[model samples]
Target chain A: MHSDRAPLGLKVAAGLGLAFMHLPILLIFVYAFTTEDKSYQWPPPGLTLKWFAVTWGRPDVWQALWLSVKVASISTVIALVLGTLCAAAVSRTKFFGREVISLLVILPIALPGIITGISLRSAFNLADIPFSFWTIVLGHATFCVVVVYNNAVARFRRVSGSLVEASMDLGANSFQTFRYVILPNISTALLAGGMLAFALSFDEVIVTTFTAGQQQTLPIWMLEELVRPRERPVTNVVAMVVVLVTFLPILGAYYLTRGTDTVAGQGK
Target chain B: MTSAIRFSGVSRHYGDVRAVDNVDLDIAEGEFFAMLGPSGSGKTTSLRLIAGFERPTAGEIRIFGQVAQGIPPYRRNVNTVFQDYALFPHLNVRDNVAYGLMVAGQPKAQRHGAADGALEMVALTGYGDRKPSELSGGQRQRVALARALVNEPKALLLDEPLGALDLKLREQMQEELKSLQRSLGITFIFVTHDQGEALSMADRVAVFNEGRIVQIGAPETIYFRPETPFVADFVGSSNVLPPEFVAQLTGRKAHGALRPEAVHLSEQGHSATVRSVSFLGAATRIGIRIGDVPMTMLLPKSDTFPKVGDTVTVNWAAEDLHVMDRA
Candidate 1:
C-alpha cells in the first residue's frame, strides 16, 4: 500500500508523518555540537566539539555510561540464555498451556512500560529486595527476555522438525543435535535478538525509574541533567552517543531479519 | 547372517487414522529395499518406525535381531536421508558429514579425516568451507547422503531423498546412490512415490497402498506378477481391463492388468482400433480400443506407429496377463 503511486496528498501525508516522528531525533543530532546552552535553537550561532570533550572528562558521566553498558550487557546475556531456552521449549515441545506460557513470557513487555515498572517495583518491595546492579539487571531481563524469546522462537519455527529427526537418526543425541544443528540455525536470530535487547536496555528509562533507587544509568542520568539547567549540552552529547550506540545494532537487526519474513510475523 | 531389519505386525495410528497399518517386512542385509507407493501410503511412516523416530502401536521392530521398541533414534543403528536433505545451512559439507561422528564424541583429528574421506566419496572434496546455501540442489543432496552415510550405520533409511530433484538429476543421483549402497554393502530402505525410482534402484520393492503393504518382491515380480490392482496400476504403466474383456482369454477373475510393453502391435492376436499414438523418444506408445475397452501398447521406435484413425491389432502372450485381486 505504501509503495503504490497514490495521489500527491497521500504521499505528502506519509512523508510529513515520517518527518514528524524523526524530526526531534534529527534536531538532537544537529544541535549536539551547537554553541547554544539550554533550549534547542534551529539556527545556531556556532558549533564546537567542546561539549564532547567535557562529556568525556566528567567522571559522573563515565560512571553512568559504564553502569548502563554493564546492566545492558548483563541483562542481554541473561535474557539470551533464558529466552532461548523458553523459545526452544515452546517451539520444540508439545505441552499443555504452551500458548499461555508464551503469552506470559511476552506479557511484561506487551503491557505498558509504566505498568510493568510499577508492578515490578511493588513485587520487589514485597519481596524485600533492595535496588542494586542485580536488581536493575533482573528488571531489564524481564522485558529483554521477550525480545530474545521472540527472535529465537521465530528462528526455531523456521527450522524443519525433520532436520532434528535426521540429526538424531544420524547418531546425535538431544544435546548433540542442539549443539550441532539447532544452535547453528538459531545463532543469527539469537545475535539479532541480543543486539536488540542491549539497545532496548541501554535506552530504557521508565522501567528503570521505578527499579533503580540510587544507581543512575545513562538514560536516567540524561533525564536528571535534562531537568537541571546546568550542563544541559552534556545531556545532548550523551544523547548523541546513546543514539549512535543503539541505532547501529537496531539497523543491523533489521537487515538480519528483513531478509526473510520471520515466523513471528505469521499471523500479522 | 540374519536379515538387516524386521518389522513384525507394526502399526502406527494417529487417533482414528491408521497411518501405518499392521505391516510385516524383512529387509535382507546389504540389499536395497524400496517402498513404492503414492503419497499417504505409510511408506515414510514405516521407514521412520524402523529408524526409531516413532514407536509402533502394537508390534515388534528389530534392527539386526535387537528389539528397537522404545529405543530413541540416536541409540538406533540407522541413519536417514530425508526428502529435503535437511543439510545444516550453517555447516559446510565436511562439518555436516562429520556431525554424527562429532556427536558420538569422536576425536577431532579422526573425525576430520573421516569427514574428508566422506566428502571425497560424495565427490564434494574442497567444499568444506562452503555452506549448504552455496551448493546447488544436487550438491546439497550429495552432502546429505555423505552426512548420513559417514556414520556407517547398520542400515540407511532414505525417505524420498530424490523427491526434490528434477527428473534428469533424480535419474543421475539414483545411479550414484545405488552404486554407493552397493560399494558400502549397507542395507538400504528407500521410500518413494515414483515407481521408476524404486524399480531402477532397489533390489526388491514393496508396494504400498493406503497404509498397507500390498505386495513385496523383486522389481520383476512386482511388474510381472502384481497381486493387487493397486500394485498393478502403480508399479508400471499398465492397462487395467475388466474381467469380462479377458473372459474368453482367461477363465479366472473378471479383471486383469497388462503392461503397455507386453501388449504387441503385431499383425496377430486380438483385434483393436488405434485410439491415439504418442511418440515418446525411443519408444512409441499407442492407445488402442478393443471391443469398448481401452488399452495401451508400447512398441520400439523401429516399429511402424499406427495413425489415430487406423485399425491396429493389439495382443500379448498368453502368460503375460496377471489377474488382479479386485477389492
Candidate 2:
C-alpha cells in the first residue's frame, strides 16, 4: 500500500516532464498533416494527405536528403576507426600525459559546437583548403569521434586485461588475439557508439554552417524553405522524415549498450 | 632429457623495486614445481617471466635448452590458467575451448572434435553452447582448464588457479589438478601464496621472500629444515627460537625451528606460562612464552592441556628441533 501511494506524486511529475519535452515534437507531427501551407495556423483549416506526395516529387529535397545521409555515414565510419584506436591506446597503456590525451579527445564534444565550427573554418582558410562534402564530413567526425571514444574507452576498461594475456598464451599472434578475443569483446560498444555518432551527425547544423560554403544539407534546405515561403507543409513533412531518420538510431544505441556488464572472468 | 625450463640469474627490476630479483632455477620435464610465497614476494612475477609476459632485466631464460628471452608469449610453448579463469564472455563453452586451435588455422571440424575431447577430460562434456556468464565459478574454471588443455602445451603455468573457489572446492581442484598433471606428464609450474597448497601438490617448493628464493626443497625438507627465519615462520607457522636461545640450549650460535605438533607436555622440561589457547576442531593450539621468546604447541583435542595462565613443562625430541646452518 505504501509503495502504491508513495509513487503517486512521482508519477504525476514524470507525466508532466514527458509532456513538457514532447509537446514540440507533437506540434511537428500535427503540422505535417495540416491542410494550410502558406502560414502558421493554431488550428489547421483542415487535415489532408497532400504533403506526403508533394515531398516525394521535389528533386531539391532528394538532393539535400542524399547529401545528409552520405555525410553522416562517412563521418560515422571515420569515427569508429580512429576513436576505437585512441580508446585502446589510452586505456591499455601507461605513458606520460596519458590522462591529458584522453581529456583532449573529449574536448571537441565538450566545447561549444560553434567554437569547434569557428576553429575548423579558420583552420581550413589558413591551410587554403576549399570547403566541400569532405570538409563537412571532417567537421562532423570531430564530435563523432568523441562519442565513439567515450563508449569504447569505458568498455575497454571494464574488460579484464587477462583475456588478452590468456589468448596470447593459447598461441595466438597479436592480430589473431585481436580478431579472436578483443574484437568480439568490444563489438557491441563500437556498434552503439557508431549509432549515436550517426544520429548526432545527421542533425548537426552549427558545425555544418561554418564548414559548408554553398552546400544545402537537408536541415539547411529546411531553413531556407522556412524563410522564403513555398509549400510550408512540405517542410513539416521533411521535418517528420528527419525525426524518423534520427530517432531510430538513438533508440538502437540505447538498447545496444544496455545490460552489457558481463566481462570475461566476471562470474565470481 | 634436458630440463623443461631454466632461469640463469634472471632479474626484473622496476625502478628500485625488484619484482623478481636475480633468480636461478630449473624444473625437469614431467615434474610439478610450485613457487610459493606471501604477496609481493615475486612468486607470481617469476611465473610471468617464464610465460614470457615480462622480460627479465638481466640474465637468460631457457625452455628445453632454447633461449626464451625476447620471445613473445604467443611464440612460447606454454599455457597459463590465470587466477580468475579468464573465459571469453562472448563465446560459448565449446568455442572458447576451440579458440586456441581456431587461431592456429585448424579446420573447424577438427578443432571442434578436439574441443569436445578437452571438455570431456575436464568432466564438462555436455556444457557446450552455454556462455561463460551462465556457468558457475567452478564450471567457468573447468572451461578455462579445457581451453588451455586443448592446446596441448609443453608446460602449464597456473597462477593460483584455485584461489577463487571455496575451501572444499579448492581442495577438490587441488586433487584433480595433481592427478591431471600425473596423467599428462607435462611440466607444471604454479604460483600460490598458500603454504599448505604448495606442500601438498608440488614435487618441489620454492619459497620466495622479498623477490628472492630463500629456500628451495622438497615439502618435508622445506617444512623441517627451513634455512632462514622467514621460511620457518611462514611455512606452517613453526616456532622460531632466537639465536641466543639456541646457543644457550645447544652451545651453537644458530637459530632453530621446532614444529608445534612436536612439542610435548612432559614431567621434566623447561616451564612456560600459557599465554593463549585456540581450540581447533581436531586439535587445540596453546601459545606460551618461554622466557622472552613466544612459542606455540598443538595438542590433540583429547590431550590434557593447561589453561591460559597456567604454567606447563614442555619438551621435544632432539631431532624435532632443527638448527639452521645459516642464521
Candidate 3:
C-alpha cells in the first residue's frame, strides 16, 4: 500500500523534511574519507581509509576520546542511580514540596544550558573548588539527571501501585518488591534513559567549557580542531564516529519506548 | 473464640473526612467473613488497615493474636487478592506465584515445587511460562489466587476480587474461591458490594455503612434481620412500606421492609392496584402502589400473575415484616 499510493505534494514535503534533517550527516560521512584536499570537498575526491588511521594515530585524539568516555561513563552511572531514587521517592510518597523538587530537577533542562553552566561555575568558584574531571562530570550530570529522572518518573507512574501492594501482601519486603517488581517493570525505561544520558554526556560541550580547566574532552578537541588547524578530513572522521556511536543507542531507545505505546490503545 | 482479626476503636481520616470511623469488630478464625457495603462505606479502607497498607488514625488492629500497629504488610501473615488482581506483568506465572517465597529466600527447588503445587490447585497447571498479559481474565485471576495461596498466609484478604469478571465467570470463580477457602480452612476476609455474592458465599457477613459496622451476623441473619434500614435496602431489593400501612400491626414510624419474595398476591389482605407485572421465567415480579408508597411482590411464575390496574391483595406473614429505626 505504501509503495503504490500517496499524494504527490505530501510525499514531496515528507521527503524534503527527511533530506533536510539528514543530508548534512550523509555529506559528512561521504567527505570524511575523501583524499582530495585539506578543505572539505564533494565528489571530486577518491575514497580512502587513511584518515581513520591518521585519527587513530593522534595521541591528542586518543587522550580526548578517553577523557570523554570516562566522564560520560561516570556521569551516566551517577545519573542512573540518583535519578531512579529520586523518581521512586517522589512517585511513592505524598509529601510537601513535591512540585518544587520536580521543578528543580526539570529546570536544568527547561532553562538554557548556558545559564546552568554559568551558575554551576559560579557556585564552584565560590566553594573554592578547582575545575577538573569531576567538575565536568558534575556539570554534564546536572542535565543528564533531567533526562533520566523524567523517563524514570514517567515509567514509575505507569506501573500499577497495586502490584507493589500485592507483592508486599504476599510477604515480599520493600527492597524485594523494588527489585523483583518495580525494577523489572521500569527496566526498559531505565535502559532507554541511561542510553540517552550517556549520549548527552558524550556530546556535551557548553557546560564542559565552563567546568573543564586543562582537560580536553572530545567535543572540546573538535572545537579546537575546527578553529585552529584545518584538518577537515580527520575532524569529519571523528564526527562520523561520534554520530554513529550516539545514533545507535538513541534508535534502540526509541524502539524500546515505542513498543509499549503501539499496543496501548488495543488494550484500553 | 479468640478472634483471628480484631479492630478496636479503629479509625482513619483522610484530612477531615473519616474513611473508617471508630470501628470495632472480631472476625472468627477459619470463617469466610465478608464485609458488605456500598462504595465509600469504608469496607476497603478497613481491609487495608488490617493488611497494614494504611495506618489507623486511632486504636489498634490485632491479627492472629499479635498487635499489627507499625508492622509492614510483608511481616503480616495475611495476603490480599487485590480487586484488580495486580499480577506482575513482566514475570511468568510460575515466577509470579513464587514471588513471596523467593523474596523470603526459599531454596530454588522448594520455591518452584510450592509454586507448581499452588498453580495446580488453581487449575493453571501447564500455563506457568506465560506472562500475565497472555492469560485470559479468569486465568489471570486464578494466578492471583495461586500467588497469594503459595505463601500460605494465615488469612487471605480479598478486596472485591471478582468485581472485574463477567457474570458467568464471576459465578464460577466465586464457587471455586469459596471451596478453596473451605478446603484450606484458613480465615478469608472478603469484601464486595454485591450482596448476593456476600450472602451466598460468606459464613458470616459484616454490613458497613458510612464508615461504621451497622450489623455483623451469619449470612441468613444478615439477609433476614438486617439491623438498619440502610442494611435492609443495601443488602436486598426491598419494597419499603411506610409505617402507616403497617401501623395497625407494628406501630407508628416503624419502617417496614418486606423481601420481594415474602409478599404474595392473595385474594385476602391489604389491597393494591397492580402497576406492572414482569414474568421472569422462574418468578414473576409485580409492581404495585399501596397508598403513596411503591411496593413490589414476587410470586412463583407457575402461580397466576396479576395484570396491570388489577386490584389485588398483597399478603405476608407478620413475622416476615422487618421494622427498622433508620433509612
Candidate 4:
C-alpha cells in the first residue's frame, strides 16, 4: 500500500480524523495548567503549576487514586486467570453448547455499561454481598474478563496444534508441554491482555457508580468534582494523570503485538 | 531382521470416515521403510499411530515387542519429525534441539553440549544461537531432524517431512536422510506421497489407498512388478493395457502393466499412429493409438523420430510385459 507519494486529500483526511479524536483530550490537558478555576475560557487563561500542588495536598484525591489502582490491579489479575482458562476451554476442546458458552463469556462487554452496572448491583444485593472495595473490583472484572478473553483466545488458536504434538514426541509430558511450548507461545498475548484489562478497569465510570458504596474510585471522584466545583483545574490535573496511566500501557500493548502475526515454526 | 514395530489389524474410524482400516504391518529394525500414497490415503495417519499421537480405534500396536496402545506419545520409545518443523519460537535453535533432554531432567550444560553434537551431525554447527525464524526453511528442517534424532529413540517416524521444500532442497535432503539412516542403523518409518522419494530412498515401500494397503514390497519389486493397476499407473505412470489387449498379445484376459522405457520403435510389429509427441530434456514421450487403443511410450530424444499422425510399428521384450490385478 505504500507508494512514493501519498495524495494531499488522503493526508488531510487522516489529519482531521486524528484531530477529531484527540482534540478534546488535548483541551483537557491544557486546562490542567490553566490558572482559571471557575470556568473553561478558551484562549484567555493563564498557565501555572499551582493546581498540581493542590492535587498533591488533597487526601480525598489520594484515597480515590489509591482505591482506583487497587481495584484495577486486582481485577486485572482475576481476569487474567479466569479469561485465559475460559479461552483455552472454548478454543481447544469440543463439547455441547461450546459456542453458547463463548458468547455468554463475552456478553458483559457487548451490553451497555448501564445494563451491566444495574445487573451487577442487583446480583450483589441478591447474594447479600457488602458494597465495598470488593464490590467495585467485582464490577470491573466483568469487562476486564472480556478484554483478556478476546486476546487469549486468538493467540491460543494460532499457537499451532503441531507444536503441542511435537512437544509430546520430544518426550515431554502434558505439564511439561504446557510449561515449555504453550506458555512461551502465549506469553505475549497474556501480557497484552493484562495491560488492556488494567487500562479499562482504571477509569471505568458507570459500573463504579452502582457498585461502590462509601468508596470513591478515581473516575467517580472526577464525576463528583465536575458536578460540585472546588478547584476545577485540580480535577483536570487528576484527569491528566489518569490519561497518562492508561495511554502508556495501550501503547505498550500495540507495540508488543505488532509484527507478530506469524508464529514460530510456521514455515512455508 | 528383528521386528521393531508391528501393527496388528489396526483401524482408526471417525464416525463415517474410515481414516485407517484394519491395517496389518511389520517393520524390521535397521530398515528404512516408506509409506507411499496419495493425500488422505491413511499413510500419515499410520505414521501418527506409530508415534502414539493418535490412538487406534481397534486392534493393537507393538513397539519392540511391547504393547503400545495404552501408552502416550511421551512415554513411547519413538519420535516424529513433523512436516512443518514445529520449532518453539521463543527458544533459540540450541534450546529447541535440547528440548527432549531438558524435559527428561538433563542439566542445561549437558543438554546444550548434546544439542551441539546433534547440530553438527545435521551440518548445522554454529547455527544454534539464532532462532528458528532467523533460519531458512532448509536450516529449520535440519534443526527439526536434530531435535527428533537427539533422543535416539527406538524408531523415528517422519510424516511428509520434505513436502514443504523446493525441488533442489528436497533432493538434497532426501540424500542426506538416506545416508543418515544408514549410519544411525535405526528403524525409520517415512510417510510421503512422492513415488520418486519412496523408490529412491526406501529399502521397502508400502502403497496405501482408501485407508488400506494395496501393495507392500521392495522398491524394485514395486517399480518393476507392480501387482495392481493403481500401483503401475501411480509408481511411474506405466502404460496400463486392458485385459482385451492382453488377450490379443499373451492369450490371457488379465490386465497388464508395461513400462514406457521398454517400448521401442520396430519394423515388423504392431502398427500405431502417433497422437502426441513431447520432447523432454533427455527423452521424448510419444502418445500412440493402436487401433483406437491409446498408449504412451518413452524414448531417448533423437532427430529421427515419428511426429504426430505418423504411423509407426512398436514392440517390447516378452518379459517386459507384466500381468497385474485389476484396480
Question: Among these predicted structures, which one has the highest lDDT?
Answer: 4
**Arranged by lDDT, best first:** 4, 2, 3, 1
lDDT of 4 by residue, A1-268 (tens): 7888879999999999999999999999899999888988897369999999999999999999999999999999999999999999998888999999999999999999999999999999999999999999999999999999999999988887899999999999999998999888888888999999999999899999999999999999999999998899999999999999999999988987787888555764
Tens digits of per-residue lDDT, candidate 3, A1-268, equal 3676788999999999999999988998887778864676567469888888889889988899999999999999999999999998898888999989989988988878789889999999999999999999999999889889998998888887888898888888888888888888888899999999999999989999999999999999999998886657888889988998788889988887776642210111
Candidate 4's residue-wise lDDT over B1-327, tens digit each?
A: 699989999999988899999999999999999999999999999999988888899989999999997799999999899999898888999999999999999999999999999999999999999988888889998999999999998899998889889999999999999999999999999999999999999999999998999899999999999999999988989988899998899998888999999999987788999999999889999999889778999988788889999999999998999998655
Model 3 pairs in collision: none
Write one digit per residue (lDDT tens) for candidate 2, span A140-246.
Answer: 99999999999999999988899889889988988988888888888889999999999999989999999998998899899999999999999999999999999
Candidate 3, after superposition: displacement of residue B121 in Å? Answer: 1.4
Clashing residue pairs in candidate 1 are B243-B254, B243-B255
Candidate 3 per-residue lDDT, tens place, B1-327, comes to 768999999999999989999999999899999999999999999999989999999988999889998799999999998888888888888998998999999998999899999999999999999978888888888988999989998899999988889999999998998899999999999999999999989999999988999999998887888767777788887766667776876775777778999988677888888999898888888899876778888888674666899988888988999887665
| Clashes within 3 Å, all models in order | 2, 0, 0, 0
Separate DockQ for every predicted complex: 0.40, 0.75, 0.56, 0.73
Best by TM-score: 2
Candidate ranking under TM-score, highest first, comes to 2, 3, 4, 1
DockQ of 1: 0.40
What TM-score does prediction 4 earn?
0.93
TM-score for each candidate, following the candidate numbering: 0.85, 0.98, 0.95, 0.93
Cα lDDT for residue B174, candidate 2? 94
Off by over 4 Å in 4: A1-20, A34-50, A94-98
Better of 1 and 2 by DockQ: 2
Residue-level lDDT for B122 in candidate 1 = 87
Find the candidate with the highest DockQ and give its number: 2
Estimate how well candidate 3 is docked, as a DockQ score. 0.56
